[model samples]
Target chain A: MITIELNGQQQPLPTGSTVSDLLSTIGSDGKSVAVLVNQQIIRPENRPTLMLQEGDQVELLIFAGGG
Target chain B: MDLLQLGSHSFSSRLILGTGKFSNAAVMLQAVRASGAQLVTVALRRFNREQAEDDLFGPLSTIEGVTLMPNTSGASTAAEAVRAAHISRELSGSAFIKVEIHPNPQHLMPDPIETFEAARILAKEGFLVMPYITADPVLAKRLEEVGCAAVMPLGSAIGSGQGLANAAMIELIIRESSIPVIVDAGLRSPSEAAHAMEMGCGAVLVNSAVAVAGNPPEMAEAFAEAVAAGRKAFRAGLMQKSGSAIATSPLTAFLGATL
Candidate 1:
């Protein structure tokens, strides 16, 4: 298992897990969420092939209410 | 129709509603429908699985004729705001971005320097930038020159419900700006929104005023009506002020005395 920073929190993921696996582990369908890995946007197509590495700073963003 | 033109997009409704501070998502959605606002503002947040219901993209999109203008609220710098704009464009598939860069939470006053920088960059990048700013004519004109679709000057403070505290300065902004001058904050009631419109503001962006009302939907409808009436009054032109009373009826005395 490797530790990856998810939304500023440390999370352990299986070695060589793709971004899709991470989304699955977190129960996210990746439909309405924007995923960023190491400050780079991880597109939906790239999420399936891109593997997560140790200390990868992953940030998920969603639209919320604001003025 | 006097459409509210922002860049290439046009909207019949001038009431811009902010998707915040509502009691619940359901109520917020209902208020949105009642407001008749074609242009709505939203914000980006870190995804929280525990509070997934807070996500408004899908729910807000369900409303007909509503266009999303996602705001860069949390960003404190120009670079952060630009980055947020890119991400929001990707998710929302819209070119409208509200460059809101207020570093201090206490006052929530926009930093003119940073906002100017962000608006310049975003406008150059082909995004329709709507910058939230102070009631400064110089700053508002600067933003317009930088290709901003509109300048949203606060009436007072955010959520204060002060109702046009800086009316004098806002009037100056409206006078000098070629782009739309929108009153974004510090409004408490529909009457305030109407007053802002009557002062020649292209539109008014309201959130706390309707969100905290007794009945959010009913208040939203009232604001919609007020905005329409004010816009019509402005277009028709208001009567000028007079120093003394001007008699509407004929002044000639004919009943009992000679003319």
Candidate 2:
């Protein structure tokens, strides 16, 4: 198991857990978010293939109304 | 009326709405529908699941003929703005992005160098870059050369409600820009929006003036009518202003004498 920061909260995930797994674990479709792993944005197509490691910081950003 | 063209896209409405400062998402949607704005701007931020599950996009999607124009509001540098643009594209599924790089939180004045840099990169990446910039004629032309879809120049400081403190500079930008010139920020009323159109701006993006008004929906409607009226006035051609007051009636007709 490796610890990762998910949306500012530290959580432990099994070794070799990809972004897709993270989304599934959180009950999200990954459709409404822009995920960044270690400060690099992970495209939706690559989310399933990109694996998270120990101490990896992940950020999921959502779109809000703006001016 | 001719269509308002920005890059390859054309829109009938010359007023672009900003979704910030509304009382709520529901109220925002109502005002947007009332405004008749085809393109609306939204910000990209960390997805907060705790906030009411009613995401802004879900409600916004119900309004037909509306396109999402996400803005990089919090980005302070060109790289950050570029990253935000990519994120916005992936999230919003729209090619239109508003590049707003304001490092200074006090005034929220967009950084010109950063804006130009971001516009250049985003334009090459096949994104329609609309950069918010100061009312500088030269920078407006530069952004055009960089392949920006449009130039959004400030009428005054952001959210100031001062109403075109830089009207002459904005006019100069409008005159020099080959692409669309959208006057963004610092417009407080429909009359100010009309004034921007009369100065030959392609469109005006207003937020606070309507969102913070006594009645957001009604204010939106007022702005819509004002933009249409201003565009019509521009198309009709405005009379030249002169130092001497020329009588509407022929000077000789009223006096029964020739000047």
Model 2 lDDT per residue over B72-179, tens place: 999999999998999889888899999999999999999999999999999999999999999999999999998999999999998999999999988888778789
Error of 2 at B211 (Å): 1.2
The lDDT for every candidate, in the order shown, is 0.94, 0.91
Candidate 1, residues B1-259, lDDT tens digits: the string is 7999999898899999998999999999999999999989999999998998999998999999999999999999999999999999888889999999999999999999999999999999999999999999999999999899999999999999999999999999999989899999999998999999999999999999999999999999999999999999999999999999999999776876853
Off by over 4 Å in 2: A14-16, A48-50, B52-54, B250-259
- Which candidate ranks first by TM-score, i.e. highest? 1
Which has the greatest DockQ?
A: 1
- Residue B121 lDDT in candidate 2: 97
TM-score of 1: 0.97
Steric clash pairs (candidate 1): none
Candidate topping lDDT: 1
Residue by residue across A26-49, what tens digits does model 2's lDDT show?
Answer: 777887778999888889899999
